[model samples]
Target: MMKPLPLDKVYRFIEPGPVVLVTTAQGKERPNVMAMSYHMVVDDGDPPLIACMLGPWDYSYRAFRATGECVIAVPTVDLAAKVVAIGNCSGADTDKFETFGLTPLPAKMVKAPLIGECLANFECRIKDDRPVENYNMFILEVVAAWVDPERKERRVIHHRGNGTFVVDGRVLDIRKKMTKWPTYIRD
Candidate 1:
């Protein structure tokens, strides 16, 4: 039998992708890292774009406005607690990188530095801001991407709200019908 529950708080079902650390920087000011899951790939073409929603109150909001750039760092199961810590604290009052013991590496196309610990990083620039003024949404274009070659097993975490998390486990590859893997814009 099937069940129909209340739809008032249904974000956990619609969230796309695993939890990611969104890094934002502006000029000489201290950079910030935020644990976010409200993001997804809006355009998968050559110059891929991402749709993200951030509260106007977040420090990264101002950083993105000032720098027009940000980076999405994909974390694994190892950084679960740290991700919660990063989300619990406010970057406006503390240096997240120093607090979390994360290393920042220079990015190729944006001022926002990449997280050295993440398995993958997406460097992006603001492509559209219409959602920001209306609904606090942002559409960013991925300019550059980096990945760690050493991490053979990528076990990322996904937030399910209310102190619950789900880890990515097992892979079911059914590529029999697919011709080939898609190529990135850079390729």
Candidate 2:
């Protein structure tokens, strides 16, 4: 086998899963929105937490860190092209919400705005920023979350390699046996 893989490569392999829009605000001015893929649900109870990574150069980074608030918007497969467009451009140079024709809705608990077109939006406040400068990691405590009732039953879209996307389809469940098996197992 090849020698142990690099740590950076291992971390990247598990990334680019969800297609999310990271929204941030500076005071009452227009909120900036940028497409992001490095995010995950870290906890469930008592103000659910989410972890997201942002490049130090990203324009939304400072705003989010300053206000300690943001909204994670989950887009659908139909918005895949727009997501790619936003990801390709810098929010510092362009108003992505205007360019993409995405409407902004006021969030209940956070200063950031939510994408109206997204299927779900999570209003979150930064819980920790220690890892931001170190690993581009930011921990957010979800203050409020909402999902479009019409799209509640529909599958959400996820980012794949290149510009491709995969829809969340078909739920599968498998129960693990109480006894342990030494050999490897495949599903």
Candidate 3:
């Protein structure tokens, strides 16, 4: 059997990905927002699927579970400080949207609102919740998506270690022929 890895050392081993704002609304009340890095896009066509992990103790976790809806907002490098701030605080105690100066945009299919300042936003509905209670994981189906045209071509911000972050860097295009396996060598 494979040995189990310790949780304390797991975060670093996982690939560092972009930080996102998870917006959730329980019932008809105002939505709550939190910053998270444990998420990824699953598909690009039609209704996209997004997978994210949330701690059971997080306020947004319960809100998402209760409402079965959320919005994932991709922030830029300029918003790193604000992202850290929101991640450090609890939505249950403070009005994060107002404090962070985040504009809430109405979503077409979900109660949760999108963050206007973000470069990209994904409105999603919970497709399954069993994983959340069992492993703090959520799978969502994107109902809608938006992006700022100006920043669409620019690099987005991503979270690194120790309160540090890296912005989107230069792009490198590789020809498919150059990506062949070693055994498939060509002259």
Candidate 4:
């Protein structure tokens, strides 16, 4: 039997992608990081494009608007607690990198630094911001990406809305069943 759920809680059911830390900076001012999950791949080709939602209310939005660049860092399940806490605070008052003890590493293509503790980091520049007025969404083009090859833990956490979260589990190899886009499968 299906139970009725409130329409307002629908986001918890349809939330997409893993929770990521977005880093942005304006000129020589200190960089800021924001915990975000409202991002998705717009294209997976060479120089991939990503779409993320960031409204003016977010402190990082001003930096994004000023520099038009950011770094999306993917954290593993182990950093779940810190990730949630980072979102609870405001970058306007706190230096998230220092407060959270997250290491910031320089990137080759962007001014925004990458989180050393994250599993992967993608340096991106805004490709389109036409949707910002209505959706607060920006389409970004990835100029560079980095990953920790030595780190063992790889499970990523997904936000189920509110304070709840789900960690990645298990592995299923169904690549052989893929009829189309077989090239996407990796060995």
Instruction: List lDDT for all candidates, in order.
Output: 0.88, 0.81, 0.81, 0.92
Superposed by TM-score, candidate 4 places the C-alpha of residue 112 at a distance from the truth, in angstroms, of 0.6
Candidate No. with top lDDT: 4
13-94: candidate 1 lDDT, tens digit per residue: 7667689999998889988999888888888876999999888788788888888899999999999999999988898899
User: Which predicted model would earn the best TM-score?
Assistant: 4
RMSD of each candidate relative to the true structure: 2.7, 5.3, 5.6, 1.2
lDDT per residue, candidate 4, 32-104, as tens digits?
Answer: 9999999889899998999999888889999889898999999999999999998888899999999999999
Residue 171 of candidate 4: its Cα lDDT?
Answer: 88
**Model 1, residue 174: C-alpha shift (Å):** 1.4
Query: On a 0 to 1 TM-score scale, where does candidate 1 land against the true structure?
Result: 0.91
Ranking by TM-score: 4, 1, 3, 2
| Model 3: per-residue Cα lDDT at residue 18 | 85
**Candidate 2, residue 56: lDDT:** 66
How do the residues 1-187 of candidate 3 rate in per-residue lDDT, one tens digit apiece? Answer: 8899877867755645788889988876667899888887766557778778888778888888777888888888778889999999988888999999999998887888988889888888887667776778878888888988877445566776467777788776554566656443433
| lDDT measured at residue 176 in model 2 versus the true structure, 0 to 100 | 56
Which residues of candidate 1, in runs, are more than 4 Å off? 178-187
CA error at residue 41 for candidate 4, angstroms = 0.9
lDDT of 3: 0.81
- Mind giving the per-residue lDDT tens digits that candidate 2 earns over 7-51? 756754565567788899998667898888878878856788888
TM-score for candidate 3, residues paired by index: 0.82
TM-score, cand. 2 vs. native: 0.82
